[model samples]
Target: MRLLLKNTKLLQTKEQLQTCDVLIENNRIIAIKTDVESTTADQIIDCRGNLLVPGFIDVHVHLREPGGEHKETIETGTKAAARGGFTTICAMPNTNPVPDSIDRVENLHEKITADAKVRVLPYASITTGLQGETLSPITELAKQNVFAFTDDGVGIQTADQMLSAMRLAAKAGKAIVAHCEDNSLLHGGVVHQGLASERLNLPGISSVTEAVQIARDVLLAEAANCRYHVCHVSTKESVRVIRDAKRAGIKVTAEVTPHHLLLNEEDIKDADANFKMNPPLRSEADQEALLEGLLDGTIDMIATDHAPHATEEKALGFLKAPFGIVGLETAFPLLYTNLVKTKKVSLRQLIDWLTIKPAEAFQLPYGTMEIGKLADLTLIDLNSSEKIDKQKFYSKGKNTPFEGWKVFGIPKLTVMEGKIVYNNL
Candidate 1:
């Protein structure tokens, strides 16, 4: 099958946008030029002079399948990802049967093959059952083609256990993706230890809970010589730690969520559960640091940390509700409106954070636009504007904090492997 995308703007460099036409045959991009006339194709799309770029990739997301299907299934989660202009997403291994074994990994793969609407890369848990006491079968699971090892829902408790897991992951040639939170310092906190928590009269989660573990893990990763990736980085100290580690050549990379970059503890004026999340929204100072880190190459990419929960669960109020908010459907628009449109970050930089940066950090082969590359792309209408309505979301979870916010840069179409997965044009 041949698919043609006409009159699309392509980013030629960090500062250059070139209007061009892209032609795809089967799943590969076949041609890209200023114009292609009189070409025969099974399908043709006039992009209306919109931006056409490589599809966004999220390295951290929770598709609660195999057990928590009431929240999200592989099919629903991936459809949400497609709607968000993501062609690829990494599934966190925090499901019921936890993908800690090769058998579990294979089982999850079967579900993904049967139901996924877009590319889904599954992660293997670093600790068996995510208990953080015994290590998972890293060497065996690595051979099963899992993307990486991470006990994402919880932090590895002990330095010895983390070091051991890092050693095995290094030998197995897989990255150790960490959720850095020291439980001892948690103090049963729900929101960040700041003005919001104090005013709301709630227990507070300190930034040290995240930074201290990061400080320890970077040393362990250096000793094990393993590729280390920090997930949903939300603190200024965490950014400082990751920045210093990269400068010291510790083989470390980190990702910030759109919420972390856009919202902060100050935004949580009430007891709204939608604002609740692991490593909860931090202070504005931390938010500024995260953006600085991204600009300076300290933060490698932007991921959604797209955790979903049932509507009732999120409605339980902040203290009783679970720690998560759905993100897969609103990520691009939120970032584009708040960061790009406001000139805090350029459009090209935002695209790189969503597309090439995550791919490069994970060593994946799906984040470039060129002849012969896979035709996984997104066409975005930068001039379009609308309010984010949760009722129209494809995701099962409607827990986004950006609900009803006006935003631009809506995705018009998403093509994955030469097939149109989403179209709003």
Candidate 2:
């Protein structure tokens, strides 16, 4: 089959936007030029000056399947990713079965093969059952094609345990993705250890909890020569550690979530659960450092740590509620409207963070608009504006903090392997 995307705008560079037509045959882009009107087969889409770019990629997301199905599933999560212009997403391994063994990894793969609407790369837990007491079968699970090993949702407690995992992962040629948190320093905190926590009279989560762990792990990673990745980085101290590590030639990469980039502790005016998240919204100084990291290449990519919980669970309020919010359906619009439109970040750089940078960090094959590349694409109407309505989301989780916020850059269509997965055109 052949598919034609006519009159779409492509960002060829930071300052250059080109108008062109793209032609795809089967699952590969066959031609891209001024006109592909003469080439015809299955169908054609008139993009009408919309932006056609490589599909977005999210390196960090929680699908909550095989264990937390009531919150989300492979089918529903990928559908939400499609609507958000993501053609690929990596699933965190904080599920019921944990996917620590080859058998368990195979079981998760079966679910993805049968139910996923977009590419779903699953991670195997770094430690057995994510207990942090012992390492999982890292070498064996790596051979099974797990994307990476992570003990997400909780940090590996000891430096010895993390070093051992990193050594095994380095030998296995796999990345060791970490959730940096020091339980000893948490102090039973629920929100950031700042003015918000003081004003709300809630226990505070200190920035030291995250930064101290990262500082230790980077040294361990350097010693073990492992590809280490940090998840949902939110603090200036954490950014300083990561930046210093990168400067010192440590093999490290990190991701900052959209929530961290756009929102801060000051936004938490009340006890609303929607604003709650792990590595909670921090001070404005921290937010500024995160942006600086992204701009200077210290931060590698932008990922939506898209965690979803039941509405009733979140209704418990910030103190007792879960630490997460749904992000897959709102990342693009929120960033584009708040950052790009506000001139804080250029459109080209934003696209790179969402698409190519994540792919490069993880070594994925998607996220480029070139002839002969796989036809995974997204068409977005940059001129259109709409209010973010949680009720209209395809995700089973509607716990976004951006609810009712006006935004632009709505995705009109998402195509994976030359097949339409989402269409609002």
Candidate 3:
């Protein structure tokens, strides 16, 4: 099938914009120009005053398949991703049986191929069983096309173990995605260590809880000379550590979540479990610092860290509730409504953070809309106004803190590989 996307403004990079027409033939873009006479094509879409940008890519997502299907599945997750303007999403491997073996990786790929409306890339576990005792079949997993190695639910906990994993990952030519949390320092904490936690009288986790691990892991990556990507960076100190490390010429990369960028601990005063997430929201100062980091290029990408869970699971009290809120469905509008529309960031910068930056970090090639590239594109109606409604979500998980919030700039249509996957009036 051929498709013509007529005159539209596009986010070409972090700060570039252009008005052009894009022609997509089958699964790749065939032509891109400022003007093209109406040629014979199967379909033509007029994107008036809308944005035609490369589809967004979420690097860290928890598709709770192979174990917690009640919370989410590849089909549901990817569908939600497509509606949110994502063409590709990399899954984290802290699942039920953990994706550590060749068979497991292949099984996930096959499942995704069968049902996913968008591209699904899986990251294999760093350790054999994510147990941190022995290494995973890194070389074998790499041969199977695993994009990265990570045990995202927790850190390696030991420097030697991390160093070994980094060395093997570097040799295998794969990126190592890390979840920076010090289990030794983490006690039975349920919320951020701040005035809100004190008022709520819940156990608190300090900012140092994340920053300390960031420092340790940066050193480990430098020593092993490996390409490392930090997952869900949440604190001011952690941002400083990442910034300084990058200045010192370390090959380290990091991402921030939409929640961390827009919300803080004060939001937890209502005892809303959806507001609760691991590396729990910090202070207002931390939020400001995170935004600063993203603006200054200290943070390389913006990921939802879209962790989903059942409403019943989250309905429990704050202390007993699991940490996380579903994000895939709301990431685009939330960011656009808060960051871009509010002028905290430019639309081009936000688009680049979600697209090319993520593709570059994963060493993939699906982030651009140039001719001959995969026809993975997202069409968004930036003027479409909407309010946050959790009941309308496609994912099995209903856990979210943004319920009832007023939002605008929603995605009206999403296309993957020249096929329309999702659309709404």
Candidate 4:
């Protein structure tokens, strides 16, 4: 099959918005030029001057397959990812019957190959069952197609265990994605330790819990020569720690969620569970620090941490609800509307953060639009505006705090491997 996409703007290049055409055949981009007539291709799409960028990649996402399918399955999750303009997403290991062994990861890989609408990379757990006790079969599972090793829901408590895992992961040539948190410091905290926590009378989760753990892991990663990545960073101190680690030549990378960047504790006006997440919304100062980090390259990329839970589970109010909200379908629009449109960052930089930066960090091959590369791309209408509606979401979980927010940069079409997987145009 052949597809020709015409009349679109390129995001990475400095070229002006023109009537460019991208030709694809046999799942690869064959040519990119201007004034290519539509009669030469099997199919042609008039992009209507939309921005044609490389398909987005999310390094942190929870597919909830193999056990928690009621919340999200591989098919539904990947479909949602495609709709959000993502061609590749790395699945976390915190599922029922955790992906801690070679057999488990193998099974998950088979499921992905059979059902995923886009590329689905799976992670193996650092600790068996995510219990933070004995180590899992990291060496064996890393030999498979696993993207990395992580215990995303729970942090590895013991330094020795984390160090050993880092050594093994380094030897296997795999990255160690960490969820930085100290359980002892949590103190049954449910929200960020700030003014909103005080106003809501909710237990507060201090920044020290996340910052201290990141500091420890950076030292261990440097000693072991491991590629370390911090997940869902939310605090000012954590950003400072990551920045210093990068300055000292430590191989550490960090990701921030859209919610953490756009919303703060001051935005939380109710006890709704949609506003809750593991690394809860922080103070205005923390939000400012995070934006600074993004502007200065202290934060590496933007990820959704696209966790989903059932309606009944999320309806349990803020204090007792689960620590997650659906993000895959909302990440790009929210970031583009709040960050790029507000002049805090440029459109090119935002595109790189979602595409090239993540691909560089994880060593993936699907973030560019060069010829001979996989034909994965997203066509976005940057001028149009839409009010977010949760009922129109493709994923099973519709828990989002930005439901009524007006946003720009809607994804009109998504192409994976030269095939049209989703078309909202």
Per-model C-alpha lDDT, please?
A: 0.93, 0.93, 0.87, 0.92
The regions of model 4 sitting more than 4 angstroms off are: 12-15
Give candidates' CA RMSD values in order.
1.0, 0.9, 1.7, 1.0
lDDT of 4 by residue, 37-142 (tens): 7877999889999999999999999999989999999999999999999999999988989998878888888999999999889999999999999999888988
The collision pairs in model 4 are none
Candidate 1 backbone overlaps, count: 0
Residues 1-425 of candidate 2 have per-residue lDDT tens digits of 89898889988765577899999999999999988765475798888999998999999999999899999999999999999999999999999999999899999999999999999999999999889887898999999989999999999999999999999999999999999999999988999999999999999999999999999999999999999999999999999999999999999999999999999999998999999999899999999999999999999999999998889899999878989999999999999999999999999999999999989888899999899999999999899899999999888898988889999999999999999999999
For 189-241, candidate 1 gives per-residue lDDT tens digits of 99999899999999999999999999999999999999999999999999999
Using all chains and alpha carbons, the TM-scores for the candidates as numbered come to 0.99, 0.99, 0.96, 0.98
* Worst window of 10 by summed lDDT in candidate 1: 35-44
After aligning candidate 2 to the native by TM-score, how far in Å is the CA of 95 from where it should be? 0.5
Error of 2 at 259 (Å): 0.5
Residue 307 of model 4, lDDT score: 94
**lDDT for residue 356 in candidate 2, whole number 0-100:** 91
**Which is better, 1 or 3, measured by lDDT?**
1
Residue 422 lDDT, candidate 1, scale 0-100: 97
Pick the lDDT winner: 2
